[model samples]
Structure formats: structure tokens, C-alpha cells
Target: MISRSSQTAAIAFAVLILLLSASIGNAYEDVGVSISIKGTRSYKLKKEAQLLAKKQAIISYLKRVNPSAVGKSCAKQLVNDRAALIKRITTQEISQVGDYMEGSYLVRIDDEKLNYMLEELGCGAQNGATDVTILIMEEPPTKANISMILNPEDSTGVRKLRGLGPFAVFYTSYQRSIRDTIISKANKEGLKLTRLDTFDEFQKMRMSNDDPLVGVYFDDESEDFVINKRLLKVVRTRFAAQNTIVLYYRIESLYFDQVTRELNAAIAISLYDLNSGETKSVGSQDFMVIVPKGQSSVAIRDGLAEVASNAASLLMNQAKKQIRRMASIAQVHAQKKGTLPVTVTVHLKSKRTMYNVKKNLKPSMIRHSEIKGDSLILKLTKGIQADDFVYGELLGVLEGMGIKIPENNINLNGQEVIIQQ
Candidate 1:
């Protein structure tokens, strides 16, 4: 019988090997495919078998790494490509039997160029992971947590924040856990995924001078925190809908059965459609699960991971129709937003102008933006006719942002608009 220590070591070794194998598969690594062909022993037959074997090897690699994108075009071009994918092709000892050729060939390849080509075709692991962002905000389960929400009597934000410590550290660690767990779950579900870090940028915009969200912080278990959360959800969902991204969000409130004192995690999901900027159903299923202790951040995270996993399941399965709709909208939005970019130059003299300029523009139109010295440079999205970019469109948005471009200072150079302060 195997000893417990020995079994533990063996299991650890097995896990290490599996991890190593997965890591290697992500990079340029040798992929081997075996082929068996029977025919008259001829050079043409040898060439044919080798080519098929190389294509098969590439297909095998794609199937292993990016199964979802392994379409007909993935290996279609390789059929006519002469050779060079072969690291080596070995033949069995029994190369020929009587008048017919019957043997096996093993093809091995580690072609970096082929890897680049596959990436271009979106048939490799490098381009496979879908970009995703998720937010999980937690609150303590107590009368205060319940009473502050929608309580018209408590007008000031002061009541909820009384004597409570800064939630930064807890929020950071918990967000990290939520991100890692959900992204891992997404990858296992064949939704290879990565997180798009945008919430901080959005928050920065919200706190800019003249912004309504100035001085508003989150996770305070307050009445307005729910409203503040909508901004977060909006940014995440809008970005998700605009880009090929997955955004999972949850507002977790720790609650108790008033009678039994049973701790539970209450999770709420957003049904807001970021693509069309509307509510899809004003509904996503809310979840409540009895979990371990939740008073401390550590305990809440450990318990929350399980409930978050269930929420992830709901997002990818039951709520997937929403995701699919967003994707379809994204495709149409992509086509509409095309590659024709018009430059909109803003004087970056004020921090307010810098943040709000990007914030106010139609997300679909803001392509590339940067601050060059004192100027906030924006290369707006291309696709729309340059003539269609009327000052009416530009001025209205600028007015919304409290930016006034004087006639003398505003110059239109074809598709480019230069506004100098």
C-alpha cells in the first residue's frame, strides 16, 4: 500500500507535470502527428503524405490550444504550401509490403513562423483568450447594511460611513480573488479569458473636477452606493459590449436569517445592455447561498469564491443569451465604427478637460487618445464620412463637457479637428 506522504508527493508531481504541459502548449512547442498511408511506393505519394501530416499536426495543435477558432481556414492554406513544417518525418521499418506501400509517418513541428501565421488567422492560444472584466462588491450582513439602502430618512451619506475604516485593502484583495477565480472558471469553460483593467480609469474620470461622482467612494454599505455602482456596471458593460469582452459583476451583501442567524451571500447581477445602452430585462437572477463565516475579508473571500463561481455559471449559461446579444451588437457596432479616424485635439490645460473629453465622446468613436505635452490628442474612430462630423455633433458633446472651442481657435483640417485654447 502507498504511504500517505508518498501519495501526496506523487499527486503534487502529477499536478506540476500537467501545469508544465499546459504552459508549454501556450507557446511555440513541438506538435507531433502520426499518419498512415497505403499506396504504390512513389515520391509523389511520399510528398502527399508529408504535407497532409504537417497540416494535421497544425490542426491538432489548434484543437488542443484554441479549439473554438479551428475553422476551415485554419489549415486551408497549408494544403498547397510545399513543405518546411517538418521537424522530422520518420517511416516504419516495414516501408513496403509486396506491390503496395504501407507504412506510418510521424510529423513533428516547432515552426515559429507557422505560429505567427496561425495567430494572424486567430487560430492560436495567443489570440484565443476573450478579454473580460468583473466587479464584486461586498457588504457586511447587519441591520445597518439593510437600513441604509433606499432609506429616504437618512439623507446624508454620513450615517453609513460613521466610524468605518477605509475599505481599500479589502476591496483590492477581494477583487483580485474574484478576477482570478472567474477568469480561471471562464478558461475551463473553453472561454479563454483575460481581464480588461478599466474600472480605475473610469473612477478617475468620475472624480474629475465638475464630475458628479466627485468624493463618492464605494463599498460603504450605503443607500447611494447602489446608485454609484451603476456607474461601475455601466463602464464595464459598455466596454464589454463595445469590445469582444466578458464582464461579470455581482453586488454581494452578507445577510442572516433574522431567526436562525444563518450567514448567506446575496448576489445581484446586472441586466443592463451596454451595447444598446438600455436595460434588456431589468432583471438577472439574484442568488443567495449559505456560506462560512463572513465577518472578516478573508472569510468572506473564501466563502464568496463559491457563490461567485455559481454566478459565473449563471452568466455563461442562463444569462448567456444576453452575452450573445451583446456580441451581435458588438459586431454591428464594429462594422459601423470602421477604421476612419478624425483627430480631435483638446488643450490638456485642465485635468477636468483631459478626463471628461474621453469620458464624454461616444465610446465607439474614440479610437486612439494620448496627452502630448499640454494637448489631449484624440484620434476619433473612422468609418463615418468626414463631412458627417459636423460641428453640431462636436460642439454639443463639448458643451456637455463645458468645453467651448472659439471659431478662431478651432481649425478643421479635413477629418482632423484642432481645438487650441
Candidate 2:
């Protein structure tokens, strides 16, 4: 019995020793293995790993070391030297995971080790166990998952702003700039930013349903600010209309020809709405032109060239009627007290000795013609000389009209004349 008891005690002691050894080995113990990156792109590993570390809440230690002359020579000995080191290192790391150790772990990582390892494996370890805390984080969320919405109250002044004629472009560009500025400010103000792939989706979101959190998105500092569709639509419609007007009416060149009668040479005529998409017609009459022929090319080009000036006077007389009809149809009011211009003013003169004198005078010399009343009017043109001949004709016309022609009353070469009484 004593021999058997001694044998049992020895076995028990051996078992305890084994357990104690195992526990001691495990206490304050860690296993770490070095990674040898391969290839020239190894420099990229540190950056990628750093990013991965931050994302995964892991700490990475990078040590700087100059290339060893001997190691460098050995590595340069063959094309696959770097590859061999990478294989060795990887294999060691993998096989050593379950290794039993009694001291703190260490992973000697340098730029060179990274290069050698990477040359063997094009990509770094994707998912695996490392002796150290090596964490590779998952990618961040994409912009497509987020939503945007425009607000309605924000859309009020947009249309009117877009109506400022040529200034509309500046406004549009300014709006984009302002939005970007707001986003940048938001970023500086500590707001998160995200980018959406398409702006069309942004334009479609409703007011209350979309997210209102503003963010920086895409490559630019655009307000990934969410807004309601109604608001966006208001701004979009006005801007679109303004752009349409600009594009449709943007004429690269314009030319005009005038049709005129001798009596109406001095009148100014032009096409008012030339090259506009709304007025597709090529005739000046389409644009309501009523100037004398050849007065301005704008009239014909603007589709208003066809309106006759002679007949325009008649139209002017009935202006109130036309405007009233237009106003009623257009649902807009016409301001009262608008007066139409008189196109023609007629004058009558008595045919007598005075009329002959005035009529016979050269165009260079001013002359007056007698009217039914004892009055005279001067007829004038270019190149008229102020002289006695012009005055004599005027004096005769005044006397013939039964007005006393004072010597002072007849001014030579006068553009206008008055009969003396």
C-alpha cells in the first residue's frame, strides 16, 4: 500500500507541475509576428494601415530604419528575394499564433519589411488573425443612402431674382457659390458632409419627408443640405425659365433692311423682340414695329418691319381700344392716361404771291409760305443758308397773307417763320 501511495503522489505532483507551468507561461504573455511587405508600393501600406487603424480603433507603431547594405545586397541578388522574405514572414506569423510564450510580444515593422511582404502578396491581409491588434475597418456609408429636401419658404425671392434679365446668370452662379459657401462654413462649424451621386433625386424630395441636416458633399463644398421639393421647384422653374429665355434669345448675329417711302426717311423704326423663341416670326409687324422705313433694322429683324407707319397713326388713334382688349385677355391691367403719338400733323397755307416766293426759294435759303390766316411757316432742309434771299421770300409771303411784313420780322435762313401784323 505504501508503494502504491508513493506512485500516486508522484503522478499527482507531475500533473500539478504541468498545470503550474502552463498557467505561468500564459500569464503576462503575448505573441506578435512581423510582417514583411513586398514591392515598390509598400510605402502605401503605412497610409492604408493608418487609416484602417483609426477606423478600427487600433494603434499602429511604425519605425524608421535605413536599408542595410548587406540586406539590400541580398534582396537585390534575385528578383524574388523580397518575395521569399514575404513568404517566410507570413508563414511564421500564421504558424506562431498558437505559440506558447512567457514574455511581452513585439512586432518589428519597418518600411523595408512592408515592401518585402507586399511584393509577395499584391494586397495586404484582408481578414485574418494577427498577433497584435490589427484591425481593418469596413468602408464608410455612401451618399446614395442619404436623402435631401428643399423648403418652400426658401423659394420666394427666387423667381423674381431670376427675372433680372441678363443678370440672371450672375444670380444663378452666385446661388451655387452661396450654397457652397454655406456648406464650407458648415464644415468649418464642425458639421459632417456627404456627397450624393445625382442632383435630380435631390430635386424630387418633399419638404417634411427629407432630412434637414446640412453636410459637405461631393468634390465641391455644396450644401448637402436637404430641402423640400416645392421650394426647389420654385427656384428651379424660375431659373430654368430665365435660362431658357437667355438661350433662346441669345443671338450671335443680327442684320436688317428697311423699306421706306421718301416722306418718312427720318423716322426711327426697329424690331423690338428679335431672335426670341416666343416670337418665331421674321416680320417686324409681328413685334409691333411702327417706325418709318429703314429707320432701324431692329424692326424688321424683330418681326415688326411689316407694320406700316402711315397706318400706325391710325392704329395709335385706336390704341385705347386695342390695349383694353389686350388687357382683358391677358388678365393684366392697363394704366390709364396713356396717349398715342400723332404720326401726322397737317398745315394749310393760302396760295398767293407769298406762297410763290417761299416755294421758289432755294433749299439753302429759308422761305416762308402763307397760310389761310395771315401767317407764314418756313420750309427747311439740310444746307439752308441764312441770308437776305431767304428773308425776302419770307417777307413777301407774310405781306401776301395780309400780315404786315416788318423788316425785322423776316430773319434770313430761318428754320421757322412768323408773319408780321
Candidate 3:
């Protein structure tokens, strides 16, 4: 009985020893030790690490590898075991590493990178982790104001501009706040802007001349556009001739006064410059004023104003003629230089019509005159030729009233005549 008891106790002791050994082995295998990286959590790893330091650290660790202890190779084992915990982040997100503890330093991954690594490790998950914050720049609104003013030579005439002048001219002023901004933006975008104001300035400069020139000008004040000087030069150029049409008139059946030795009646004279085609009053008094049909002093003023007015018309005609002469010379000179001058002519035959016989005929009945060099050649009022002379008297009366025939150009073939110029 004592031997059996001793055997049973020895067996129980062996079993207990085996069980304790198994428990100790399992405990050693189940140990949960953590490994960590000591560098930046928020900082970019590659940029922060110097190649030299990185290489040295890796070389040192390689040197410290204990060959006797491994199952997997050190490099392979580290990669496979800890790749889930190795966080990757962009350079901008990183700040710095945290406190060191025991023999390992805490790996301070960027909050963003930390979440990323946790997700990859199958430990924690997050949707967005790499977004960045930034500020936006904007531009201010533009502001501009424009104003106008008008200045007139004579207030009364200015008020009557709508009735007389072709048009009125006005000036303008501009105020812009965002001009610089617009310029800068234009430069950045590679664009060009025309300086409209420079043209306005140029027009103002041109208008400063005393002589009249044809051009467009601006003045903000009046807010009206105008033609500064009469455009007679162009008209004369188109007409090609300046005509000096002379009119001579004599007062008939006048009774003469003996006392004071003056005539009771007077004559007036005026001329129109055909080139300009305007009727300017020329007053020439060749008569006398008398008291109750007798000579008086009142006629002197009338004579003076009349004579001056007639002389003024003649002077204008003479000026136009001179201008035409110069233009003709220029044309000849240009032709010599191989530039051809254009000439236009027109001829029309007059036909008898019942309307022409009317006693009262308007000026519109006359056809437009031909431009001959610098003169306007108006057809003279004369007789007309009818297709059939059945109503010969009516035709003659009409011719006497409204027909304009060129006298110098008339040709005769036995009373059946042809007009020629």
C-alpha cells in the first residue's frame, strides 16, 4: 500500500509539472509588446530625414542584427509586421513627434496620417483625411462718373443753333476709380486698350487754331456737337469754278430835282458767290432820297450802306474766283505728276409743256446747273422746241415762262434749230 501511494503521487507530480510548463510557454507566446517610430507624426518623413542620417541609422540597425535569433529576416519581418502602423502623409500636414517613453519613442503621426494608418491597419477607419485649408482672394467693384458742360460764343445765337447750325458740339469729363485695377487685369491677360481720351485731346488741340478746319471735336460742357467753320472749301472744290456774275441795272423814267441837285429815287446792288451758291446781300445805292419827291439828306445813309453791301458781295465772289484759280493750278500740277483730274458734264433738251406757260413760275422750275471747273453754268431762260407745233403759241408762251435754253450753244438749220454747247 505504501509503494502504490508513492507511485500515484509521483505520477500526479509529473502531470502537474507538464501542465505548468505548457502554461509558461503559452504565456511567453502571448506577450503583447508594442514597437514605435520616434520621428514626426505631422511632418513629412522623407523630407525631414537626411539621407546620411537615414542611411547611418539603417546601417547601425543592420549591424545590431543578432543572427542567432531570427525566424524571418529582420527587414522582411519589420515590413510585414508593422506596415499597418507605418503612416504615410503629405509634407504640409506634419508638425512634430511626441514624448519618448521607455526605450521607444512615441510616433507622432499627423492627425490626418494617424487616421489613415489606423484605417489601413484595420483598427480604425475614417473617410477624409488629406484635405487642406486655404484663403481666397477677390476684387473690388469699379466706380466711374461722367460730366458735361457747354460754352457758346453768343448766348442769343447759341439758343438759335437748332434753327441755323448743322449741329452742336459738347465736351465731356470722366472720373474712374477702378482704372488701375482694369489696367492691371488687362496686362495680366495680355490685352490692349485704346486711349479714347487721347483722341478727344487731339480734337481740342486742332480746334484751338484760328483758321477753320474740318474735323470732329468734343466739349463736355455743352453736350452738343458742332461744325466749327463753314465748309466752303469743299463746296468750291466740288463746284470746280467760282463765278463772277455781273448785274447792271438802270432806273428809267425818273424825274430829276433841281434844288439840292439830288435824284429822289435810288438803286441797290448785290451779288451771290456762285461757287458757294449763297445769296449775299450787296447794297449799292446809286439814287437819292428827297423830301416829297425832292432831294433830301436821308438818301446818303441808304447810299452808303447799299454801296458797301454790293461791294461786299463782289468781294466774296472775287475771293471765290481766286480760290478756284488756285485749285485749277493745283489740278494741272497734279495731272503733270500723272494724277488724272475727273470732269463731269451734262446736257438736256428743253421740251414744250403746258405747265411752263403758267404766269407764275417757281425757281425749282430751273434744272441744276453744271459744274464747270470752278463755276456753276446755269442754263439761260429762252425758247423751247416742241415735237409738233400744233399748239405753237402755247409752246412759245411756256418757253417764255419756264424754258431754260443755252443761248451760246444754239445751232440753226433753216429755223429747225439744234442747241449745242
Local distance difference test scores for all models? 0.46, 0.26, 0.27
* Candidate 1 Cα misplacement greater than 4 A, ranges: 1-176, 189-248, 258-261, 271-275, 281-301, 332-421
Return whichever of 2 and 3 wins on TM-score: 3
**How high is the lDDT of residue 90 in model 1?**
63
For each candidate, C-alpha RMSD in Å?
A: 13.4, 40.5, 49.2
Q: For model 2, what is the error of residue 229's alpha carbon versus the real structure, in angstroms, after optimal superposition? A: 72
Tens-place lDDT digits, model 3, residues 1-421: 4466555654553454344323321100011122233554423443333222322232222222211112224333433433342332212222334642112122322222222332343222111111111101111101011111112332245443322121122111001111222223222222222232233322443444321222223333553343333233332332232222212111111222334433222223232333334343333323223222221223322322332223222232222223223223332333352322221122222222322232223333323334343322333222332222212332354356555545543322221222222
Please tell me which model should have the higher lDDT, number 1 or number 3. 1
* Alpha-carbon lDDT of model 1: 0.46
Worst 10 residues of 1 by lDDT: 132-141
Ordered from best to worst TM-score, the candidate numbers read 1, 3, 2
Each candidate structure's TM-score, on Cα atoms with residue i matched to residue i, is 0.38, 0.14, 0.17
After TM-score superposition, the amount by which residue 352's alpha carbon in candidate 2 deviates from its true location, in angstroms, is 3.6
